[model samples]
Target: MRHSDVLVVGAGMAGLMAAVTAAKSGASVSVLSEGAGVISIGSGAVDFLGYVNGKKITDNPFNHLSELGEMHPYNIIGAENIKNAFASLVEISNANGYEIKMNEEGLNHTAISIAGTTKPTYICSESNNASRILKAKKILFAGVEYLKDSQPALAVKQAKQYKIFADAEINSALLKSPFGKTHRVLNCLDLARYVDKEEGFNWLKSELSKAAAGYDAVIIPPICGTINYTKHFKELQNLGFILVEAVSIPPGVGGYRLRHALINEAKKLNVKFIENCNVQRAVIENGKCKSVIALHNNIAGALETEYTADNFIIATGGIIGNGIASTPDKVYETIFNITIDSPVSVEERSDKNVFGSHLFARFGVKVNSKLQALDSKGSPLYDNVFFAGNTIAGYDFPTEKSGYGVACSTGYTAALSALASK
Candidate 1:
């Protein structure tokens, strides 16, 4: 059997954070996952808290914790831990040459989405912050013909509707394809990688300079070199226009950069990842998790293998990521086989409204302040196993916009708790 001091399930934001936190704290760490989680496809920003009761929070999010339900992860862990965790994540990113900006007031920063809507984010990468565009007297919406994800005209029309841009001068410009005549559609990741090379950098600077001359700031899809994105953003800003990156949907370049940087740092710490090992069940004994069994196929062929660790962190994502599974009559945690008490019928579980508040959105493995997974009877299921991210839930990330923020904080908290309990 393979072993380590800590075993983190789900190699997404929370899993990676849990593994890194333990390793950095001097624990030998091993991570197992079916595949990398949604970090690469996410908006690549730490959204501490955005909306409460459909109202946008304009000030320090910490001040508004009273509005959140008591069971929310922020309240469970306390505001100070979240702040420290956010700071830790920022420090790690900066050390890896990835710069995320946090303002002094701790208010949410607005960012441009692929659809051209302005949304609140607690902290964002320097390249994607919309403050420059919001302050600019003149703005340009730059789009590339090859990148269908961003439409300059749509952005121009949509972004202006926000009060922040009400008086700003705005226009749209469709630039020529920097990647010569490749008829296939390109996502943000494709263009960002291209900008890593000399040709792509030259094309962007030369073309954008000519197009964005009159505007004080220009918003473009994320095309900064994924590896040296901050340096590229700084170099391009020297061309006179305040360079702002608009985050694209899915296949996200911004998220990919964060994941890339973190994974690189994890590698430096010698964290091990067991690929293709889909964890099916947890081997719990004596009121503690002893090991986990995963099915895998490799040089040894398809078979079941057991992995033991002193502490285990479960970050397997929620319903969206299939960490929680459901059927007509049952709702449950997949690996632990804990049946969740919920509505008996499907209609009672969810609302007909797609974006409307639904009971199922907040369903997850309930945890105590210590972050240990609790059983249906409200007792600790396993002393050594802690749940992080969407796996331990009380709030809905979709409406709260607190996915990565909670994921990071709870993952770090869970890691610390697991180590402390031992």
Candidate 2:
């Protein structure tokens, strides 16, 4: 029933940035996302590497793009455009009051500096916003018992080391294995009782009822249902607590909140959203996409929705996020059915330092200079369908903590070009 100039899917960093830029350019845009994991338990910072141009560790955006091609030959082909993407991202962030600073010593993809292992430069957005909202107040870091016991306590201790003032509280909810022994853990948010079950919800209400009035916010560990943050916020709001926001992923609360925020923002801009609207196939006429047929819900309850667009930008995330698929044996884009050119080799799967302490640290989707989705034969799939972010192939951001950085750059640049094409 609705039509837009661009139909962008997924609400991760790339999706959000793409939608925002496209909408601002006066193009009607809509975003659909099944779910996203980037923000929840993700590094809440934009990452970019630095190079030593002279005595200074010059953070040249061009050099960063070039290095990506050298390391992951299939990773980046639009090397010049990639640099422009980063430049656009820097411009946007600087204008938004978030100043991204560069590291001095030829920035490594990943590094362990005094500051909880500093990797590439982190462009902080909500830097002042997060602190401003929590000014001089204490936060209750509600701990999921099993999770704390399972993973290294380094992140928690490191948060304290960074002087992020917060206190930890353990939830009594326990997760056990078949033998009735504790296997993993769940926080108040994760426990079935507190989330979907009525009894647990009541218990959470009664227990947190008092503390809700005292603290600034209740910080929860990334739980299974954390991605539906709007729903979570409603529950918290009903109990008289202001749901500030969550941190970035492994702990998924932040990504959920970030997705919710983007959707809400889009709605405010009069952008239409059709969730569960799965694009089944694209109709191309004369090498340009004419329309896209989508399935809403399922066959019995499904309604076929057709959207005709002048252009399209694919923000679907990479393999790990379901935008693209790559196992030990194969790699391909899921929606458009495009194959990647020279996907990451199995040998480079895990570098000797499994932790990934180098640049282009994570595996990324490979793309040409125009960011077109490429096939296994190294041919461009479609001229109209451009891509951004993790789906591009070759480079890895998780290891580099440059996931957000690359995603933003690629997303911004893609939207700009799509608009120009129009």
Highest TM-score: give the candidate number.
1
- Tens-digit per-residue lDDT, 92-177, candidate 2: 44443233333333333222221222233444323212332334354444434454422223433554543334442312222231
lDDT of 1 at 54: 83
List the candidate 2 regions with Cα displacement exceeding 4 Å: 50-65, 70-121, 125-184, 188-249, 298-300, 327-329, 342-365, 374-380
Off by over 4 Å in 1: 180-183, 297-301
Q: Tens-digit lDDT track for model 1 on 169-227?
A: 88998888866567688877888888888888888888889999888998888888888
Candidate 2 TM-score over all chains jointly = 0.61
lDDT at residue 161 of model 2 (Cα atoms): 48
Error of 1 at 23 (Å): 0.7
Clashes of each: 0, 23
Would you estimate the TM-scores of all the predictions?
0.97, 0.61
